[model samples]
Target: MAKAIQKITLDRSEDIPFDKLELSQKNVRNIKAGVSIEDLANDIALRGLLMSLNVRPVLGDNDEETGRYEVPAGGRRYRALELLIKQKRMAKTEPIPCIVKRGASTSVEDDSLAENVHRLQLHPLDQFRAFQTLHLQGLGEEEMAARYFVSVSTVRQRLRLASVSPRLLDLYANDEMKLEQVMAFSITNDHVRQEQVWDTVSRSHVREPYYIRRLLTEAAVRAADRRAVYVGVEAYEAAGGVVMRDLFEQDQGGWLQDPALLEQLVFEKLKTDAEALKAEEGWKWVDAAIDFPYGHASGLRRFYGERTELSADELARYDEVKAQYDKLDADYAKAEDYSEETETRLEELGNELDRLNDRPHVFDLEEVARGGVFVSLDASGELKIERGFVRPEDEPAGEVDDADDGDNDGNVGVATSVTGGISVNGKPVAVETQEEEDDKIRPLSDRVIEDLTAARTIALRNALASDPIMAFVAALHAFVLKTFFLYGSDSCLEVTMQSAKFGQTQGLGDTVGAKEIEQRHEAWGHDLPKTPAELWDYLVALDEASRQALFAHCVSLSLNAVVQPWNRRPAAIAHAEQLARSIGFDMVDAGWTPTVDNYLGRVTKAHILQAVREAKGEQSAQLIDHLKKPDMAREAARLLEGSGWLPEPLRLAVDETPAVQSNDDAAELVGDNVVEGADADLPAFLAEDADSEDAASEGAEVEEHRHLDPAE
Candidate 1:
């Protein structure tokens, strides 16, 4: 009882002449899509016909073959062949490969729809690997680009993606990572590091491409950094240095792998340039550095020279250019829109005017011989040469004062050193006598004023710090003055805080806090208006929340908790303490604790013991008192790990408005946690005193006491 299966006949295929093949009207493709007909023709010309056309025989009314074929599925290929024939690349009489379908059950429309819908495109990863293979097969990037009709940059990107770590490629192939994330990994070739970064970012909430790049380039120097810019990438590469580039995104200038080498090149070039400048300018000295601090020239006396006189021809040219510039500017300002030609001409005229005005200064030969230039890089990475600076040590001594010579008539003779300024009416004013000048107080020197003001500012800061309400009000006052007042006030204590510069510290720029601050500053600066006149309105238009946040950031920048050996600033230190107390600010919360590297190793044994005694009790302090300084410090650090202890300078004074506590809570928050019980097993160091009555009583009370640890 088995059912019989019916057999089906297949359609026949045959070759037909190119001239005999006609386009099918039943084809479903009406509009143009992927791969233009022109491109298809070129492809067919390069690598003959890869696909045979699906054709059905056209029959006459007699039901016989018409010796002609009609293409349905391969319409594009037919058109390409026809195009090639028209271009004389192929003959109309040439035989064309065709699959002839002589059945009526399956329509040409069905065949055409199936052919277009059933085809699959290659995966991106596969395409990347294919490009890599082609590159390995001796096909140049430009050639591949030409063959595929893609840009050279696109080809490069695919190659870069293919060059990523094998693990990353596997991840991409397995659909474990996104294509953009994989592109980020292509920035570096180190498989281990790539895997490490991937593992890290895979768990982070933000797995953006930029964050990945940031993490990878954390230790690397930016190509736009002053050192890297000074030493061109070409030179760095020529000297065997490597650079990590991002092909998918704009990386500005990419990342330099070898910062040390770049720095070395920068210094060497700077030194050579400095020497050249010194020799050419006949300077006393040429101090060269990659950068000079904010106040590098604070103590130096600067003298500017007169600009050299211009020749008659130069003067005429300058006047002509200035006139042209003024006319063009006025015209442009009056117009609703600027004309390209006028703008270009204005720029040219401006440049010419600058060229005529930017004449070299003519310094006195004697002053030039005594002064020197400070050569460094500016913020924009350009050579900044500050000339005509005379150090105090290099200044010529003043003439010694002598007793005023008197004539026999008993009248005092004026010294030649006497000098006076001319009156507004042109007559020389009488010089004041020494006695009269002594009676009238003279203005203090700049250095002295700075020192004294620095002291007063510190005292005021201390007073402000002790009162948080006052600090807040002062910040608001400062903001209001800056926003509403057009001119500066007479008050000497204006809280104009700027970022602190670590003049002596090396690698200060590499610190985490410094980088964060710089990035935030740049972000804010980019959003701010360029014109100072527009700034007040812009700030006023901002929301209240944004204004407060900006105010807080600006105020926080003014907080000076720094301690230096040479620059004591005792009042500032005191202010820092008061501020800490006012805000309940704990250094431990700010990622600092007693450690051998930062604190313990640097302090004495006695100091360590005292700290332990204050943190832990007397018994705990005695336990490590006998050890050497190093051992004591290490032991003290372990015992005081979470004890909320601070050094003297960092300690806050007692808060006047201290939190009120209950009797039980006061006892609990007094010191180290102490249990109300007899002494448990004591350490060997304290065993000798374990039998003492005082120790027993103290142990019972110490056991019940507890205090909050800032480290917690």
Candidate 2:
């Protein structure tokens, strides 16, 4: 039925029985009663009542209180308004706007029962109270629903919610517990057991309703004593207790002292078990906790076997030793800072020594001389060789007679003894020596020459390889000659010849080749000899191209290995000298040794002279004449003769000859009556000339007058 609007005043002083209210306590389910009363009070004070109370009239026993009404809803709003009234912000005389159901003659007991059961839903605690009341009245679920106008299931749920222990119910009331948790709590009929579960949950800070449900379900499955122990263990671990192996043994035997202490002992035991398991299996505590919570205790007992108790004295001594060791470690760490500079210097020195050791050995003349053979210079300036027993003519010529003496020689000649051996350097040396002795008697000069040849060959090969043009030239030289210095007896001559070949080949007979040669000479001074030997030396000393070519070749070779393109010019002679040097020949200058700047200037001057000749031929005679004209003072008539404004014939005539003045007595041409010849046109010409002279004089006078006027 639609609510009838009514102006109803709430009696602040009236003590209306809460039971008489039409609000249903069973329906008063927890709804996160948002915003505390204090907050709501503030909201009410700021904003007046926003909603009216829904109520129905309560009939007295014999119509004595037929007009009395009870609120069906808006209890919260009614209380807020009542507070406003008490605070005198709203007058008591002002009636509160209300929605009423008229002629609803329901008894207060029936209304109270209806309010508690049907009109207003109650909190779980309130529902529990109502359910107990109705249950005490011996009302069945169906009868109670009929009285409250609700479903039987609804009554059962409320009754179940009510059956939860007061401690657990308080969790619901405070909004700490959820309906699902209350339902889960209602699974068991024992309040003592529920309280124990609640205590476990509260201690463990396991506020999740789902976890609570799971715990209840788990408790239902396990034995009560085991469940209690598990709860204690969970609570103990939650409280930061470390359960040991001994605690588990005590727990299994039912020797738990205090319930809380049992939790504490189990937690303590867990820590000891964690340490033991970590030591034996390398399992972390968290991993162990995940693997086995209760079963871990059994594993711990089996693993530990028996606890090895440590005396206080032993622990103290161990702690002291650990402290001293830690202090020493800290001191050592501090000492590391002090030695860091020395260590760094030592490391740098060690690296420097290693680098120095890695370098090639320096040339050792003393060591070369110590091998019985000595280095000597020949008359031709070439290195010479002498055996240990031989002496050169320059060495004071060791006494020949003494060398032949029988006492000095090993062999003795008794009239027919062997006397066929030659005496060398004061020693009698056998001509036909043993193969081993002969092999050991190599000349020092020959060895020195051999070593020098090897070193030169290695250095040249390295230099050639480092420079692409030089390498190409070297290879080409070796290819053409079919004999490298390293392979020939005259290695030095072969090397010199090879270098000459490179120079000749690189200076190819072409303009581009010439330019490249010129450029090379420009960069490297032209004073460098154009000989093959000089070119080879130049290439060897020219480290710039070598380093660049080395880098380029390295990169190109690396890239080519992956991307094989056949067109790549791996050994291109970019410069003419490179090709010339590579060909192992001299760059013959053709009797023309032009420096770069000189050659360029000569070519430029030739071009400029050719252009001037061409311009002189192509230009007009007048333009050329104008060019030839001197200063204005020197050739004032030439300017007038060549002026483009004049007729072509007149200009040509005036320019061809000098202008001549006519005498006054020669002819009085026109009004002046002057005539030089009896020519009929001459008079007109003179007159025109006289008139032109007069006009010129007048114009000059006008200009002078303007100037004088300015001065004045």
Candidate 3:
């Protein structure tokens, strides 16, 4: 070895004329990847030739020098240079730096393959740091992106990564942490906090990126939150509120740093809006808040207003739409299956008619004089105004008299509205009551009355169960009590309806299902009697159709089709199916589309692909199958939208939820369903989609919902 290594002759490098170099077919990279030709050209123009091209002399038919060189590697650079010359940006005879291979034993193809195969891609951290270093050298993100042949957002993301705590960056570089974890940490710039989260996650087994982000931003409020949406990001920023963003992932509009500031902004804006609305709408007073308890107007007497009649033009539009709808329905009446075009036109016509008929209610000036409005933000961040609620003091003395109403039930807490006597054997049987003989009348003791009413209650229950109509009314009375008067109670029917809250689910309150349910609940709540004592008389006055409609609405609230693992209710699941089947309930029609946050994002990679494949096609799924889980999920959501594709939990099975063949299971199912309430259960968002659709349908966390009904 001391004799020295054998001397070797290196390939000679020289500046070859641009016209003298041509690309060789031996280049291994045929398909385009990474940076594009145009981007590469632009990068090359900005930073001259950073790497020299490899070339071999072209031999003519005579086996002599043809004065041209064939480029085995760096063909892209050759094309880029050739392009610049054609654009007159460079001379045709411009010298291109290249290594000229002569007398080399290696073939040109071998050289090209070796060059590509042996090249190691720059580490992601290195690239991120390089971008950061350029920014430190006085280059803005935009300018650096232009020079690097990447997007400005990409540059910012890389810089964000570099801005992460150096210690975490080292851990990432050493492969102790993942790219996603680093991306999550980059959501904020606080190194101390970043290191602290890292330390917390590093010691725990739950180091998922989602968990990491949660730990970091646990205290921050989401910008998509109702308050933030009401105030708006720009307004918040204008008020000096900071929003933390994750450029690498969907952050649901990022997280707002200042909850107090957001609340202040929301209140101020709401106050302004309420004052304006009160002045314009001519209400006695307007109360503004971000939210109110479900039945904030429980004790207040609400008045219903007649809708303003449609004008000639509006009437004509409604007639036209109605005619079209009728014609379409007639045309499709006999068809076994409706064509898509027909279905679409029918939907459009129906929507048009609904819009035309949805005339705004015009309250009487007298009613408006005494009634106040409750103005608050709805699930969708829009202002919801509840009008025509009158306080008890505001009502004229004796305007609403107890005796004027037809019911003669002595006790205000009576559950039945049987007029005078209890129904016995399809006949009214009056019960003698002891009345005061003196001018100062005395009443029966609580124990005596309770005993008498208990027997009366038993008779009423038996009779009402036989009479479907009254059974329906009885349920509605219980629902009204629970819905409107939470603090007090008078109804004998012990029914409860609690609307399961989605305080923890992101953007759930803003869902279409949520908004529709809340609006429906509020409408019924406002229309109901103020106190349970008046409920029996008030419900008895409604027409048959109106009462049935009210009963249906009340019964709909206690629907809990959610499948939870801890509380397995196979019979209930099947019952929900039977219910869905009865109503032609389609989750797709309910406006629940597959979304990354709601569905695809929660599932495994294979499920995402399967969903895409089913909704779109194999080719479509294949295109995104190679992407990472997040990207694949996002792509699948887009592809599934408007396709009417439903996940297993949402899809109504063709047969049923399976065996309800057991009689005990059947009786149990009926008993469970009989307890329906006045608050809507969280619909299958495919909620949590936590369980397998094949294993169980619409698996949701176990939450209780209650309801009541009436008799003939």
Candidate 4:
């Protein structure tokens, strides 16, 4: 036809006995890849020759037929067949379907290369759908994994991915969605919710798997939460509460789907447990709550019962342990360096001694009967039973012991107890003494003592002021005694140090700053003098360096930068600002930053917007202002994080010109410009919105002026 097209004939295909086939050395695949031989063999056994092997007839040097074939392409399949035959699962002479390539024009290497390289892999979505079908058709995950030569987890993950909304699955199939994103959607069974979350995340800038999970579980309670831990997952499930889990990641416990049901179970279980404790401990009343806020026991009187007396056996064991500990400790001290065996023995002995010393207190039967207990869950989810709490109204009336039983007072007769009288200042003193009013020596009344102490303190202050060195030393002494001593001190110079105790601020105890403050306090307390009277002498003996260190610590304790909502002391706050400027106290250096739980999330929308606008930009603030309060707060926190922006109250007071960038300088200036009881500093947008509202509402807003310092 045009030069007469050559008649084309395809390779002949036929079934050849497995025993007649031989391996070809010309095969291009020298290195192992893709599925293993064992898995391929299993797959072949289960599905049986899905693809035909390519074979060429063997030829001798003379170019004559040898009645045998060599496989070039499909080498893995040929190996799998050989394995099946070796295992006796298939007959050696069994017919194997194959395509025979003939003629010298076509090379075995070319065929092998084409066979290996031209193949296309099955799409992941197709695999997922097929696995899902198999699962729906009553195939177990393990069986499917074995049949497909994959891990059981892989099979489960594929199935989970397929179970999401068909729309999302379609998107995944169409290559518009990531596998991880699809896996995130597989966490929930609600198809509608999966689609909704997808819609939201698809349009959002942050479409990571974690963000998807967060949005889905925004309303759900974490399994690690106090309430969830209190009611365990098994119990929650038993109570018909569903838990959503991520099979693709380590979801630290997972999310409880039904918060209502979880809370219900938690409260019910807590109530039942509380009742059991009440019955066991014989408490007059039992108060149970999910959370008992810090200082909940402020007004409640806490009394300790006498420690239970040790039995003879226990006392003997304690003595033995104590003796061993003492010997080991002394030996270790004598050694220049620690010996492993000796140190270990000392530690063991010390632990044993401590165990012996930790004997439980034995409360009086009457007290136990009248007192109550607080039943709650600790951070570790264990039952925290605070016992022996006697309410003020429930206290028993005082009973007077018989006065005439002894000498009207509970005292031993001096004449019977003493052999000789004591002398003071060369004057002999009577064994029996009584307080008597006299001109030279009279017992000072309480009021007189107070007045005298007040006068002495004034004189001391004046004298100390005149002598700076002495004043510093005295201040340092008072600080050291207060910090290191556990017992009440009678130090003439009283330096009132305030612990960073939170009252109006919620969640303050859980802050990092609070923990550091507490640790510092404890460390100082361990080194301070225990007795108040000895405190003055100890300070006097301390070196100048130690005195300076103590002075700094005491002055730091009196620093108050807290901006409470109800109590807004302008003069005090202004002075605190001035102090900050003087000391160069940088809040950023203290590691304080904007966070959802710390600052941004607890403030108003206006404040959050202001923070973002200041820290990030006006555009960043606008991006989050349209969201709901909680969402906006969370986003604002993200934008403002690490920006080193501080509220007006937390900023340093500016003096003259700043030597650095003026981010904090602006805050200081704004703070200085603020007028008391006026909305003079309100943002233009806020002011505009306020004008549209009623006058009464505006007045209310003015009265409830927000603190410039966001002390969350």
Which structure among the candidates has the greatest lDDT? 3
Regions of candidate 3 where Cα sits further than 4 Å from its true position:
1-12, 18-33, 56-70, 85-89, 101-110, 136-142, 311-356, 398-712
| Weakest ten-residue segment in model 3 by summed lDDT | 419-428
**Residue range 1-712, candidate 3, lDDT tens digits:** 4887799888888999888988999899898888877877877888899999999999989888898999999988888888888778889998988999987898988999999999999999999988888899999988887787778999889999899999998988899989989999989888998889888767755578976787788779998887788889999999999899999988889999888898889877976787788778888767666765333454466776766889999998888889989988998998898599998999999988888877787778998988877777875688887788776657788876664353322211121122121111111233433332222212222222232222222222222323345445545655674576453233333345432222223444445555555565567765776568999998999888777666655554444444333322333444444445544556666566778766666556776777888889998988776665665676687688899986665566566335447777667644324433211222233222233323333222222211112210
Q: Which candidate, 2 or 3, has the higher lDDT?
A: 3
Residue 391 miss distance in model 4 (angstroms): 3.5
- For candidate 4, write residues 1-712 as lDDT tens digits: 4697799888878999999999899999999998899889988887889988898899988888798999999889999988998999899999999998878586889888988789899898888889888888999999988887789999988888878898998888888999889888888899999889888877766688877887888889888888888889999999888899899998878999999998788777866787777777677766666645333443344555566778899999998888888887887788898598987887788888888877776666787777776676666677777676665546665522333233212111211111121111111222322223222322222222222222222222222333445445545655664576433222333356532223223343344444444345444554566546878998899888777656655545444434333443343344334434434446665555667755555456777777788888898877876666777777776677788897543445445444676777556643323333123322122222333236786576565544432321
TM-score leader: 4
State the C-alpha lDDT per candidate: 0.64, 0.38, 0.66, 0.64
Worst 10 residues of 2 by lDDT: 293-302
Backbone steric clashes in candidate 4, count: 2
For candidate 1, the 10 contiguous residues with the lowest summed lDDT are 415-424
How well does each candidate superpose onto the true structure, as a TM-score? 0.58, 0.18, 0.58, 0.68
Candidate 1 residue 109 C-alpha distance from true site, Å = 1.9
Better of 3 and 4 by TM-score: 4
State in Å the error of residue 169, model 2. Answer: 1.5
Q: What digit string (tens of lDDT, one per residue) describes model 2 on residues 1-712?
A: 9998999764233333323444424234335464444545556676655655556656677755565556655656656656666777766555555566555565434543555366455565786679878987898989777555567877876777777788878878899777677776665566887788677767653345544544444322222244234445456446553332111112232222235554334335434443443344322111211011101111010111122344586566556655655565566567736666655655564554444334332212322222112122222222222212221221224423453333212211111111122111121222322112121222222222222222222223333333566454443543553343222211122333222111111112122323333234233333234344666676567678554554323221111100011111111111212322343422122122222221212122222222223333323223322221111112222222222221110011112112564775334443222111112211121112112235776587456544532221
Question: Which digits, one per residue and each the tens of the lDDT, describe model 1 over residues 490-533?
Answer: 12123666433333333333333444444554446545664579
